[model samples]
Target: MESLQKSLLVTGGAGFIGANFVHYWLNTYPNDKVTVLDALTYAGNKENLASLEGSSNFKFVHGNICDQDLVEQLLQSGEINTIVHFAAESHVDRSITGPDEFIETNIIGTYSLLKAAKKVWLDIPKEQGRQALEHRFHHVSTDEVYGTLELRDPAFTEDTAYAPNSPYSASKAASDHLVRAYHHTYGLEVTTSNCSNNYGPYHFPEKLIPLIVTNILHDKPLPIYGDGKQVRDWLYVEDHARGIDLVLNKGRVGENYNIGGHNEWHNIDIVKLICQLMDQAFENDKTLIEKYPLAILARQAKSEELITYVTDRAGHDRRYAIDAEKSFTELGYRPQESFETGIRKTIEWYLDNDSWWRSLIK
Candidate 1:
């Protein structure tokens, strides 16, 4: 059977998960067209999608999702039928320090995109020669929206109540509500996926996994928050893309799906794992010592010595776990990468692509 061609407007496509999703979609469906709209913010890196610039099926637009007019123009002109909304102010630390950006980008920006989607896809009257295309608005959200879970609490499911404590998560919760409202009130075709923590290549250095890897190479102290007992579910970025692909293709509208890796680890454990991996990498390949001369601890197979505990952030969630059973049973979705396999690939990527991350660090 011939595949259905999708023209996707991927907001925040220059960011970590967004860029990975763009690559996955284009590579999986070669005939489809993808237009990335990004503001190139501190977290948004164009180099993430640099390789696809010349591809006829790929286009990148440096812009913000808050610009409703611009989004509408792209939707109408490109005849975009699917909108993968990944744009947001995602960092919890940043949200705690400066909540205004999170509110603007996460809440208002999502509102803007929804309005634009509604206008172009629902409000506009189809003109002559215009194809009567079916439209879908897929909102990509985080499991944090379900708030922190207690040690004995069950993993968050599609029915989980919203109790966001952080500004970042609160804003995302609002956006998820808005997406659902648009679908119910105005009859916009929509699907939402709330995913657990994602880690992989091109991840910004500010995030945990990347931070540990990069700081190790720089021979800097690895900061652990509080007791580092905070538990989080980690999903590989490619697996996240695969979950989203299933949602876009097989998911039902007006429904929400949870995508998780089922791999839960304490923050401190993850740090130690990365440190062990680094030490092993350096011991196995003597040349890594030369490449990362500053990683003195890693060279001696003692990277864990750099671990340092810092004061915890305000309103830090104790745990977040996703029960992806709904997505698994309904859409036949399952994460392909085990944390063991994924972390190795992530470490190798960082080691191989020093230039890509060095630019961001400095």
Candidate 2:
């Protein structure tokens, strides 16, 4: 790889936000090449990036970030000039069931990447090494790091103290610390973006939005944790990709940016909204009425009927809202879609792309 071309190695590019960022950056920066390294875990599906299969500037590598040898090789031998690390075990419910993978991948893997970067960067040729040092290592993270907030409190700002409540969040916080430590101790050029809940097309099925959509499609009971009052700031996936681009291309190194839309909705509200949208979409589609008569039988089926409260998620955070004012005022960053518009687009995408989701089940 040629460093002059600004190649980026995006870890976990097959996952949800990672895939979005990969597509976003490749299209946004046509001159740059992006190499995606994903372990292809249950959550990491290659189909997400199938759209970029033949592009000259895009390539995918299946691997874990913890592989030191592979990490070192990619750093030393690629035209790789940037790294946007998005690989991690992200689901809090899964983390509660099994937390070991989160520790291994999020924390240790981040350390491995940071170590590789340090080894590659320590020996500068001195004549003109500063330009190469400008290469950015952008860390894609979650706003869950700041834990929950009271309803009346301010949203999480960059200065908000870390208060993780779950295994998943703890692992992410550990990784964030490692990233910050690497920047401070070894002078690695790094920027971190902690974001809110991301919902859009291509999302894996286990998460809230996708899970509900899939369950509704199957006419199964839609499960809601607790009373479904957990408040979360929702940001569109592509908007997140745009924020990542701004942070990677022009952000100040060693800075942390919160990326999220100001839109906040409780979990139940979101699920209800999904049901309403699905009802509207289904009513409009004559084929849906013919394909599934239950949908027509319950023409007035309220979205709320699907809601069933299960046991509250263990270690569930009460609320997470990001104050993206830094990303907004500083980087000239702004999301093009509001939550309403973004959700509608997402619902439409899922309806149009049936086979894409079906293929992922196996």
Candidate 3:
């Protein structure tokens, strides 16, 4: 690939995975310009990108992807050659309760962006068509679209037929199909990556790792749904960010990639591990034990006692694992953080960045 100058637009850049990607991209390509368009919803926090406020190469725009005018205006600037689409209603539980937002954002929002990209980047300027070919619309997706797997079944590969069970995954599945269709029909350059569960800094507290960590800190119940045996492959957020970078730059056009940590753990096991880690942290660090009065009491009383089993979520999948061999072999991409190392880093981040998460919790 030739070294062409890149001006990128990253959607959902205020959210967990997207913020990490924004940080990673700027650091990796310091000279390149990046425009971040985020809706700043409940899940998207401006504090996540607070560090990049003064950088000349970074610009943040508060907007929704579903707004065709806003999306078109950004693309028409003729600066964004790469569009990393991460905006979506991703929580399965929320999707079940009210699927309207999921459909609006995940399905319709994606179509709007694709349409805008096709028109602004591809449809106009017949003489500059070659330059347009270099523009990439990279769709960041999830592994849930493959549905659940049996305990003994193989992990989902890039070729796995999408069998989305929940509204969240179904909407994502629809968006994924739209991306591929645009590539095949309009010849718009596009690449898609379906990643497993991501855990790391700036993670919303509603997810598994953050929820368990926060609950343990406050001496609250660690709620486990069903038997808590639902297995999910967990990828560290930074590693997923790197994988996205790889796919954007080197992945084959009109192709999809599976990005995973290759580390699968049951939900209950993850909660238990967080409890054990918290216990150890409390024992080793007197300051932590002193900082949170509730945690100190819980440490003395036994943190594991807080575990509570709740009813399973509606239409919950039993397991999800991704086979990322193709990405590893083709794009020279591999996760650097093991589950143990990643979890420790995540816990440490939460311990140190109390204000960052506390504000969100309130």
Provide the clash count, candidate 1: 0
Tens digits of per-residue lDDT for model 3 on 206-273?
A: 99899988888887889999999999999999999999888877889989999998899999999888
- In TM-score terms, candidate 3 sits at 0.97
Model 2 quality (TM-score) = 0.94
The ten-residue window of minimal lDDT in model 1 covers: 124-133
**Per-residue alpha-carbon lDDT of candidate 1 for residues 252-336, written as tens digits (9 for 90 to 100):** 9999999999899999999999999999999899999889889998998888999999999899999999999999999899889
Model 2: residues with Cα > 4 Å off, grouped in runs:
1-5, 124-133, 290-300, 359-362
Candidate 1: C-alpha lDDT: 0.93
RMSD to the native, candidate 2? 2.6
Alpha-carbon runs more than 4 Å astray in model 1: 1-3, 126-132
lDDT of each prediction vs. the true structure?
A: 0.93, 0.85, 0.91
lDDT of 2 by residue, 1-362 (tens): 12245778999999999998888887877987889999999889899999899999888888889997898788667747788999999999889999999999999999999887776655442444653444678898899999899988899999999989999999999999999998898778889999999999889988888877766776667898888999999999999999987887668889999999998999999999999988887777767656545543224555557678899977788889999999999889999999889989988887778787866643
Q: How do the predictions measure up, each by TM-score?
A: 0.97, 0.94, 0.97
Scored against the true structure, residue 139 in model 3 reaches a CA lDDT of 98
